[model samples]
Target: MYNSVSEKDWVEAAHPVSQNVRSDIAGAGCDKPYFEPLIPEERPDIDSPYFVYFGRIHEDKGCKTLIEYFKHFKQKSSNKVKLVLIGKNFMNEVDTSDDIIYTGFISDQKKSFYLQNSIGLIIPSPYESLSMVTLEAMIEGKPVLVNGYCDMLKKHIELSHAGYAYFNKEEFCDSLNKLFTMTEKEKAIMSKNGIAYIEANYNWKVIIDKYKYVIENITKP
Candidate 1:
């Protein structure tokens, strides 16, 4: 499959193939960020650590990949790692494991709690037409570790210096190890970079200027 496309078609979908084609070209273009606003009631204590997975729970979307790798990560690290699975089930018996919350189709408020609290996300999809999950992850200001196979997210991760993308299950495990290995200094820097990248590129507030250019050009005679 082609890895990229023109900017024109990214947001301008003339037909069904339009969005898919645009996703290739534009690479999660200036879509809205997925950061959830924090509510007072559900905010976890600031010190607790967690990870989240948002989007469909289908096989291709990497639900299984996160489950298996997190199981291994839990075995390898003493750090408390909570996995919040947010969305409807796309398969059967995804897991029977510790600290795994399969909240079937989370509400908006619950989603914001997870978004505000979690360390980051594990997006292991081998293939996606386009990952709205990645878009939201970056928007939410959470770092993401996705699969290298998803060319769309790979481009964003590389361009925005946002997060890591593992190629195989082993690589996924290695990514987990790397996260644990990070010193507070390093994590802080990466977190700064992540937030900076979103502010500059993904945050809808700053980059809506892109739309003006798009509109100017598209409406030009």
Candidate 2:
């Protein structure tokens, strides 16, 4: 089974035996997938200009890279953009800068609060089967910044036009600046696009329907 279309393609290319298996792609659904219910209304504080990064704070997840890129972004951009790091820190090294706020292992409620209000969400992981947090952010009509190396994440951004992706330090910094400078109208459009994408593709009802169809076909006599 695959969680994303990109992952399905990867398996088909990398493993010949995958052709024999009954495989299907069912993306991970978001906590609140539909837009009709709408996100719990919360006033986003305009005074605070910060992007949020949630997940395990480790090198593989690209936490270090995010910090470095943000540092560079701060140097280049005049806007006082901050980077809020959420999740447990496994690394020993730390920065004492006030610009980077580390909130280690927050509750789901707090996580949602941040996701709904932040400028955007960042997932710098080099690899991902399917980053559910990205979808969660989308549910809140929040744009995302993803690592270009992760094909699945990149595909999400491309299909939804919900955010940007970066491959290198230069690209990362450039994308950050672009996100920072985006107008309120532009951001709103991207956010709405993201929500629509999630509702159509990653909702639990849609995923279950796909799974049911696949199963019924396989079970047919």
Candidate 3:
């Protein structure tokens, strides 16, 4: 079983025998897979608070680039949006500012709170099999800004219309600007679209059904 389409392709290329097996795509489900009942609740103004990057803080994860693009955005725009980093740091060169906060190794409960309140989630990693953090953010009705080099992440953004994908610094800054300037109604629509997409594609019920089908086929005579 593969967690993503890209993973399946990679495995088949590396091991020819993988082609004979019932290779399938079963995406890693969100940590908080179930959506909350939609009730009228006050959410923070989109431009008032911050955007978040929650994952391993390392060079491969593109933490440094994310920080640089965020700084560039803040310097160019009047928007007071902050960037919050939530994970353990493996990168030595990262620095924090009044606009950037590092909350190293937060609890899952705290992580969910940040996801729920943030303007959006930024995943700068250029490589991912499947990003659970991105799905978790969507479950909370938040948009995601992902790196375009990763086909899996790009596919998620395109199929769901849940967020933006950036391939360069200019595109990264542009996406941040666009997300910040969106109207409340537009943000709400994006959020709704993301939640619906996850429910249809990544929810446990859908994943379980896929697994059952694969198992039944393999077990059949």
Candidate 4:
């Protein structure tokens, strides 16, 4: 099974020995309570009007590039938006300033709090098998901003219509600007679209049924 179509394609083309690829993205099932949106009173002390990134703070994950792009956005945009990083810091870099706050490995509750309230989640990673962080944000009815250069990330945004994808600094800055200026109704619509997409495509029950079908077919004469 392949975690992404891009990965499957690469393996088939490069290996030449692989065949009959079946796609199986990461299953989406979680404790309902854990993912439920928190009230304003219950949210942690994160700055409002922010975009969040929840993965390793490593170069490979595009953490450094995200920072540079965000800083560039801040310089020209009038919005007081911040970028919150909520994962372990592998770069050994100091978490600095209110503009780019680093929580450095927060709990699921707090992470959910950030995700549910933020403008949207931002993923700059150029490589991914399956981005569980992106799926989790979608499951929580939030939009996402992902790297368009990554086939998997780009596919998710295009298929879901619940977010934007950027291939470079110009696109990245422009997408965030659009997100900042979006109206409440527009954002809500995106939220619903994201949730519906997740339910239809990633639900574990659906995944299990697919797995069972594959197994049965494999054992058949």
Model 4: residues >4 Å from true position, as ranges? 15-42
Which is the winner by TM-score between candidate 1 and candidate 4?
4
Per-residue lDDT of candidate 2, residues 124-203 (tens digit): 99899889899988888988999999999999999899999999988988887888888989988998999999998888
lDDT of 1 by residue, 51-76 (tens): 77888888878788778878877777
Model 1 TM-score on a 0 to 1 scale? 0.72
Each model's lDDT: 0.66, 0.83, 0.83, 0.82
lDDT of 4 by residue, 1-221 (tens): 56655666677688775345444544445322466666678777765689999988999999889998888888887778998888989996844777989888877888877877798999999998778888888888888999988888888898899999998998999999988888989988898898887887788776777787778787554
Worst 10 residues of 2 by lDDT: 35-44
Ranking, lDDT, top scorer first: 3, 2, 4, 1
Tell me the deviation in Å of residue 214 in model 2.
2.0
To one decimal, what is the Cα RMSD in angstroms of model 4 from the true structure? 2.8
State model 3's lDDT.
Answer: 0.83
Instruction: Give the TM-score of each candidate.
Output: 0.72, 0.87, 0.85, 0.87
Query: Which segments of model 3 are wrong by more than 4 Å?
Result: 9-23, 31-48
Model 3 clashes, total count: 0
Q: Please list all clashing residue pairs in model 1, or write none if there are none.
A: 5-25
What's the C-alpha lDDT at position 105 in model 2? 90
Q: Report the Cα lDDT for residue 128, model 4.
A: 86
lDDT of model 1, residue 173: 70
The stretch of ten residues in a row with the least summed lDDT in candidate 1 is: 18-27
